[model samples]
Target: MRSRGLFSRCALVLGLVFLYVPILSMVIFSFNNSRLVTVWDAAHSPTLKWYVALAANEQILRAAWLSIRIALVASTGAVILGTLAGVALARFGAFRGRLLLAGMTTAPIVMPEVITGLSLLLLFVAMEQLIGWPKGVGAVTITLAHITFCMAYVTVVVQSRLAGMDESLEEAAMDLGARPGRVFFRITLPLILPAIASGWLLAFTLSWDDLVITQFVAGPGSSTLPMVIFSKVRFGVTPDVNALATILVLIVATGIGVSTVWMRYQQRRRERDVLLAAAANL
Candidate 1:
C-alpha cells in the first residue's frame, strides 16, 4: 500500500513537471536577449527587439485577426447546429441510421488530418463548380472547414451532458402544462447551459488551433495565425512567437478559470433556490 501511494505521488509530480516545464521555458526564453533565442539575460540586459519586430510585421497581425474571426464564426455555427443534433440524438436518435449517423459524426476525429483537409478542398471545388458560390479559399472557406470538424466535438460534449441529465425534469415541466417550446426554453436549455458553454469553448479552441485544414483551405491574404507561426517555426523559433503563445496560454487559462467559477456559482445558486422552495413547502 505504501509503495502504491508513493508511485501515485511520483506520477502526479512528474505529470505536473512535464506539463509546466515547456511553459516555463517559453516564458523564460521570451526574454532571451540573444537573436538565436538560446540565451537569456538579466532584465536590464535583455532586449525588446523581437516584440518591436513582431509589432512591425503586419502579416502576423493580419493572420491572427483572420484566425480569430474564423474561430468565432465556426464555433458559433457549430454550437447552434451541434446542440440541435445532440438534443435530437439523446432524446430521439434511436431511429433508422442512428448508428451510421453517429459514426459519420465521429469519423473526422480518427481520420488523418491530411485526408480531412484534402477532402474539404475537393468538396469546396465541387461546390464552386456546382453553385459558383464561395469563390475560393478565404475566410468563408476556413470557417466552413472549422465548422466541419468543430461539430463533432460540440456534439460529443452536449451528448455526454444530455445522457447524464435527468429526463424527468422536462417531463415534469410538461406535466405542469408547459408548452413544448416553453419546456425547452425554460427548463432544458437552462439545465444544459453549462454543457453548451463548454461545448462552445471547446469548439472555439479547436478551431483556433487547427492547422492542416486551415492550411489547405487558406488562400491569398487569408493565412491564419497557425500558418504564420508554422512558417516562422520552420525557419527558427523567435521570441515573438513565444510571446504570442504565452499570450494565448494566459487568455485561455483566464477564460477557463472564470467560466468554471461562474458555472459553480450558478449551480450553487440554483441549489439554494431549490432548498428555499422546499423549506417554504415544509
Candidate 2:
C-alpha cells in the first residue's frame, strides 16, 4: 500500500509538471532579451521589449478585441437560453417531449467540435443562400457557433443547481399570491445566481479558447487571438508570442482572484445578516 501510494503521488506530480512546465517556461521567456524564444543569453539580461512591442502589434490587438467581443456576446446569450432551459427541465418536471428536450440540450457537450463546426458551416451557407441575412461569416457567425455549444455547459450547471434547490421557497411565494414571474425574479433567480455566474464564466472561457469552430465559421480578416497565435507558432516561437501568452495568463489569473474574493465577501455578508436576524428573533 505504501509503495502504491508513493507511485500514485509521483504520477500526479509528474502529470502536473508535464501540464504546467511549458506554461511556466512560456511565461518566463516572455521577458527574453533575445528574439528567439528558445535561446537564453548568459551575458544578456531579460527585457520588456517584447511586451512593449505587443502593444503596437495591430493585427494581434484586433484579434484579441474580436475574441473578447465574441466571448462576451456568446456567454451572455448562452446564460439566458440555458437558464430558461434549465428552469423548464428542473421546475416543470414532466412535460411533453421532456426526454427529447433534455437530450438535445446536452447533445452538444458530447458532440465533437469538428462535427459541430462542419454542421454549423453548412447551416450558415444554407441560411445565406435562402435568406441572405448573414452574407458572410465573421464575429456574428463565430458568436452564434459559440452560443450553440456553450449553452450545453450552462444548462448543465444551472439544471444541477436547480435540482438540489428547495422547492418550498417558490411554493411559499406562490401561496402568498405571488405570480410565477415575481417568484422567479425575487426568489429563484437570486438563489441560482451563483450557478448562472459560473456558467457564464465557463461559457466565456470556452468561447475565448475556441479555435476549431471559429476557424470554420470565421471569414476574411476575422482571425481571433488563438488563430493569430497558431499562425505565428507555425513559423516558430517568438518572444512577442510568449509576451502575449503571459499577458493573457496574468489577466485571467487576476480576474479569477478578484471574482473569488468577491464571492467570499458576499457569502460572509449573507451569513452575517442571517446571524443578526436570528439574534433579533431570539
Candidate 3:
C-alpha cells in the first residue's frame, strides 16, 4: 500500500509537470533578452524588448482584438440560449419533444470538432444559397459556429446546477402570489447566477481557444488570435510569439483571479444576508 501510494504521488507530479512545464518555459522565455526564443545569453539580462515589440505588432493586435470580440459576443449569446434550454429541461420535465431537445443540446459535447465544423460550413453554404444572407463566411459565421458548441457547454453547467438547486425557493415565491416569470427572475435566476457566470467564462475560453472551427468558418479579414498563433508556429518559433503568449496568459490569469475573488465575496455577502434575515425572524 505504501509503495502504491508513492507511485500514485509520483504519477500525479509527473502528469502536472507534463501539462505545465511547456507553459512555464514559454512564460520564462518571454522575458529572455535574446532575439531567439530558444537560445539564452549568459551575458545579457532579461529585458522587456519583446513585450514592447508585441505591443507594436499590428497583426497580433488585430487578431487578439477580433478574438476577444468574438468570444465576448458568442459567450453572451451561448449563456442566454443555454440558460433558456437548461430552465426548460429542468423545470418543464417530460414535455413534448423534450427528448429531442435534450439530445440536440448535448450532441455538440460528444460530437467531433471536425464533424461539427464541416456541418456548420455546409450549413453556412446552404443558408447563403437559400436566403442570400450572411453573404460569406467571416466574423459572423465564426461567431455563430462558436455559439453553437459553446451553448452546449453552458447548458451542461446550468443543467447540473439546476439539478441540484433548491426548487423550494421558487415554489415558495410562486405560492406567495408571485408569477412564474417573477419567481424565475427573482429567485431562480439569482440562485443559478454563479453557474451561469461559470458557463459564460467557460464558453468564452472555448471560443477563444478554438482553432479548428474558426479555421473552417473564417474568411479573409477575420483571423483570430489562435489562428494567428497557429500560423506563426507553423513556420517556426519566434520571441514575439512567446511575448504574445505571455501577455495572453497574464490577461487570462488576472481575469480568473478577479472573478474568483468577486464570486467568493458575493457568496460571503449572501451568506451574511441570510444569517441576518434568520436573526431578524428569530
Model 2 ranges with Cα > 4 A deviation: 1-10, 267-282
Task: Report how far off residue 42 is in candidate 1 (Å).
Answer: 4.3
Tell me how far candidate 1 lies from the true structure as C-alpha RMSD in angstroms: 2.5
lDDT (10s digit) by residue, model 1, range 81-155 = 888878878887478877876887788778889999999988898999999977987888989999988998888
- For candidate 3, the lDDT comes to 0.92
Q: Go through the candidates in order and give each one's C-alpha lDDT.
A: 0.86, 0.92, 0.92
For model 3, how big is the CA root-mean-square deviation? 2.4
Error of 1 at 219 (Å): 1.3
Which 10-residue span in candidate 2 carries the lowest summed lDDT? 36-45
For model 1 the TM-score comes to 0.90
Clashing pairs in 1: none
- Global CA lDDT of candidate 2, please? 0.92
Which has the higher TM-score value, candidate number 1 or candidate number 3?
Answer: 3
RMSD of each: 2.5, 2.2, 2.4
